[model samples]
Target chain A: MKGSSPLVRPGAPGRAGGPDTTRQAGHRATGTGSRRAARSERLAPYVLVAPAVLIILGLRLYPLILGVNFSFTGDGDRNGMVVGLDNYLELADDPLFRTALGNVGLLVLLLPVAVAIPGLLATFIYLRVPGHRVFRSVYFFPAVLSPVIVGSIFNLMLAFDGPLNTVLGTIGIGPVDWLGDPGVTMFTVVGVHVWATFGMALVVFLAGFSTLDSSLLDAAQMDGASLARTIWHVVIPSLSRTIAFVLVTTMIGMLTSMFGLLYVMTSGGPEGSTYLPEYYIWIQQGQMNRPALASAASTVLFLIMLVVGLAQVGLLRRAGRQD
Target chain B: MKQRTLWSAVLVAGLTVSGCGSATRTAPSPAGSGTSSKLVVWDWKSGDATAASYIEKAKADFAKKHPDVTVEFVAQPFDQYYTLLGTAIQSSTGPDVMLFNGGGQLRDRVDALLPIDEYVAEDRQRLAGWDAFSKDGKVYAAPVTLQGHPIYYNKEVYEKAGLDPAKPPATWDELMTDCAAVKKAGKSCFALGNKEGFGIQFFLSGLGSGVLTPQEYDDWIAGKRDWTSPHVKQIFTLWKDVNDKGYNNPGANSTAMFNDSWAIFQSGKAANVIGLMSDIGHWKDFGEFLPPDKIGVMPAPVVTDGATPSLAYDGGIGYGVAKWTKDPKLAADLVRSLTSTEALTAFYAKAGAIASDTTIDASQSGPAAGAIVSAIKGGKPALHVALSSKTLDLMGRVSQKLLSGSLTVDKAMDQMAAADKAS
Candidate 1:
């Protein structure tokens, strides 16, 4: 040990010893190098993931926590002062907020129709319907257009004295107040939203269709099954996971993505019947200068989404197990 | 070792960006640490084709005072202006100067605004609509234009209906008779758009003077409102009655007060509208469609016997200095330049704003503008402007319900009363 030089390589001639001493030195040096390499290998994964973790912490989780904390603070004269559940209490008492929550329920009820339209279209396309290529593009076209453009287009078409009403008149039917009737405005907006977004879901369904077991369909066909029966027996069972994914994603889209349409189409009008929680949050923060109250509404919305998402996953898993 | 160093550098870079994003910026020095080479101004009007000359004139005026300082005017969309301003206020980092609507909008965000009273004192006598931008006896902004709700009518429609276009309705009965004739002539009596719940405010302020007695009107403006008063009830009742009687254009609830209601009037589909005096939907906008001679500004027809109608006016818009500005004096000077006579006159001539500068000549702005100018001396603050932002919003929603027959007048009044009281 005393005679060995620091710069001496394991294989290089060193000291009076020949190949035996050199081989022993080589193993000693190699052991230290391997230990260092192993340490680097262990840390590589953490280094790779560090940026994404920082981004999520900085952009998402931090703001979410800040918003929840801000919800407890006061606005205006009492700004920055904690007011406990005062903002939440105010949200509960507000009729417009109540209406917003009620509309969320309505959107939930309409979620099945929204998912099915896309699922059906995707199926047709997957089955190689005539002009399928064109249909695929045409269906997805609206998805590319901004909600503002769609809302503006629909406003002209759905106006009381608009072309749709004129067509109804020619057909000997009375005009329907598509956007003006409180009872019908929410439905009209939802219908437009579905029309605008179904293409996206359709694409997802088609992607799901790609992985479908062709043999199952062929077996159903051999059993003399009708188209609908075959679809129910073969395609649906095979695409259960896809169906679950669509259901969860579609619900989330309805809850979050309808803001632009609501803003342009109704502005939560016809007696605030079309107010969604997101719109309500905008009104509170933007219009009414009640950011604290808006944050409370946001927290409530987050909880609602969390509960809805969890329940959906639980149900889908149970159904999968039964199947 | 090199790979580990590179990865470490990448991690440091990523964290650095995130740290900058999450860090709270230090408040800008109130005394202006040093004179900023540039000043940023935010307004919805600066981008308009009509307001281009006005903006140029304002910039020129600003340049005269500080040739070295550059002023950047950011024309935000009016829909998102307040929301953006609120975000700016929260972050304590926004334009040095920003535009604000009169009354509740200015009042609510006074915490973020620098009081420019001393800076704007010289322009006080020249400008007309100061009360609207003042909160708690302190001025947060300088008035740029006098916004008023003037009942504008199409003279050509009157001619087609065989009614005297010159002699517009002066009482409730005459208005009803005229509306009947207009209806028979296949034209709507009013071009109303309540989609944003804004139409109700215009309607309330435009027609309020005709229903409430002068004393009651004064009391209401002074915050001594009686929402259950017979006159107040009549205002809401008349709104419903007018809609029920087929006076407003069909689907009024769905119609937007913005370019839509304005469009309805412009296209000659409706005879009359409660139009603005500043910004859009004014005599200038109407003049663009109808012949200048065909646009008429009529006083509100008396709805009650004791009622004495007067114009409802307020500060339409004004620019205020932000509290976070590096240089308050510089920002205030910029605001003053924005409202200078040369700038406001250009604004009036091009944008057709009823310039808040009282001495701005209105002779070339056509007869309707002339009438508006004449009525300003007797104009009262807008009734809607007297209410809090929350109440005004609630009134908008309830007004739609009242028009749709979902809520009775009594029920609507109760809601308004509660909202007014709470706000």
Candidate 2:
């Protein structure tokens, strides 16, 4: 194995230099000076990443550690105290925490539907259809608005005497209780969430579509591939990375970004139907005066993100290996 | 040497900025030289506008008297006012005298407020219900207005439903019967939107106090009694009964207090509304749906066989002196001025709310204000504000669950007990 290493070293010099004196010079340089070069080269990756590493450690990791430490305590009265794992133990019996978990699961299941509709909508715009820019701008307008603004607008629109009911009246359809009914409140919030976020997903898919080689699409068309077939077989495979990226981001956004909408719209009510874990954490901290419970809830949220992120990283790594 | 020069230049720049800040410390008032150091007074009531004009008059009057004190009046939107005040007071940079919501939350921040015992003692009888403004016998706030939540009904709806327009419901059964009739006549009878839950508490507690004694209420608040008791269960059952009877708007659970359900009542789609004293000024516009003679006011209903009917009473806003204010006496003067009968009378004229002072007779108030005062004075006891914070949250949650069919009265009561225990 030691003798064969010399042959492997020759491949690098042979590729870089012509097979004469240049090759000898390359070999000489590698044999003599490569050790020092390799040491710096190995450290170069870490040197480039140092700032980001420090930032993550300082901002993200430190807070996460502090939150976990707080979660173990029964510090509901004071800001914090050390009780040692009692908070996590309490979670086993916490009905609200369980409800929050179930709601988060529901949110996760609905996220793909939320992401896909916008993804396809953007794909249509990317195909250069008539009034595509106008369509894109209109579809993306809600994304530009703050969640509070969007929520308030939806609250007005869904109100009993709102314009929506007026339109329903014109159609001779009875009014649907969009926000009042517990069963429908989640769906209404989900609708608002999709409206508010789908634009960013659309734009991402459009960018992904733009990066695809047009010749491959042309080849697929020459082979009599239908649009659906082209999308499923070629386009989707080419955009798998983008799809993965959008999926992870959409999940994270849904888990964390619904607080403003929940606050302004239903306030997680008509019986906590629209209550997500994030809003629950806020309620625990602000209303319940249970910062320890909130910290525990936050720790659970952190674990969820960590698991989901690690899984995504693993999947991406496998995909890369396959490629 | 170059590094030292660079450091010296940076130091000089910092010194220049700091020097400029110090130079402006003694700057004259922007309003003018005659204008004294501006004393800001913050409040959230619409009456603030009338109060502003009153303050302008007071400023001229006070200037003629003192000639050195200047007052600047600042009013903020009601929703943002408390948060802005809280933050400002915490930072030691709030208005000299500002309005605070009178309740436990303000009581929690006692350290941030200056005790107004001296101010109260100077004119004790002029300040009505001084006990309510006192914390441990030391007054921290001066009450400005008395907000009584009265049940106002559209007389046209009553007449259309074949009920007497002159005689409004005085008992729970009468109210329910009239409501059923109103609903049958193709209009929502009562506008009870519990989506915010505060409105629910207002309605329930208003009626509940008539049935549940003050002792029972105290027992509930103190965790000695469960909500499943007949008295407490009646409140929840009444909510369910009203909802089941379709007396309320169909979308009330989703409707916000100020936005949908209340707006419906205002538009005459709903016949009856529980309105605040402040809402009396808007009655003229609300009465456009019904003739002025067809609108009538009454206290919130009492249960059958109950001794007294009750209305929810929110002690409107109170003026407080910030603890860190440079001029406590000036702040106290501002508070005293705002709460004075002259200023309050002008406020009452504009807003149609009763002045807090008992010396300002109800007979002198407008018809609407008199009605509000009568309803409040007739009330048994306001149950909602009397409950502890923990019990209030329990009530809000249990009421929500009961309405949604997720909790029965017994289960809700148990949950309330559990919540009390947990707290």
Best by TM-score: 1
What TM-score applies to chain A of candidate 2? 0.77
Model 2 Cα lDDT, one tens digit per residue, A59-142: 556655766787777863454567877877777577667777888889878977987887778777877789998998898788
lDDT of 2 by residue, B1-423 (tens): 112222433464465455334323322244445545766666665345555555554455545545677666666677545545555654566566777766665676677889988866766766544434557768888877765566777777788888897788878878878888898889999876777666667676556655676677556434466655787777777887777788888777777776555567766678887766553423444544544555567765777464455555656567888786676776687677676677676666655556676556554433444565556544433456556565666576567777667778788778766765665
Docking verdict class for candidate 2: incorrect
- For candidate 1, lDDT tens digit of each residue in B106-224? 88889999899899989988888889899889999999988989999999998998899999999988998999999999999999999888888998999999999999999999999
TM-score to native of every candidate shown: 0.86, 0.77
Error of 2 at B410 (Å): 1.8
By DockQ, the best candidate is: 1
Q: List the residue pairs that clash in candidate 1.
A: none
Reference contacts recovered by each candidate, as fractions?
0.56, 0.42
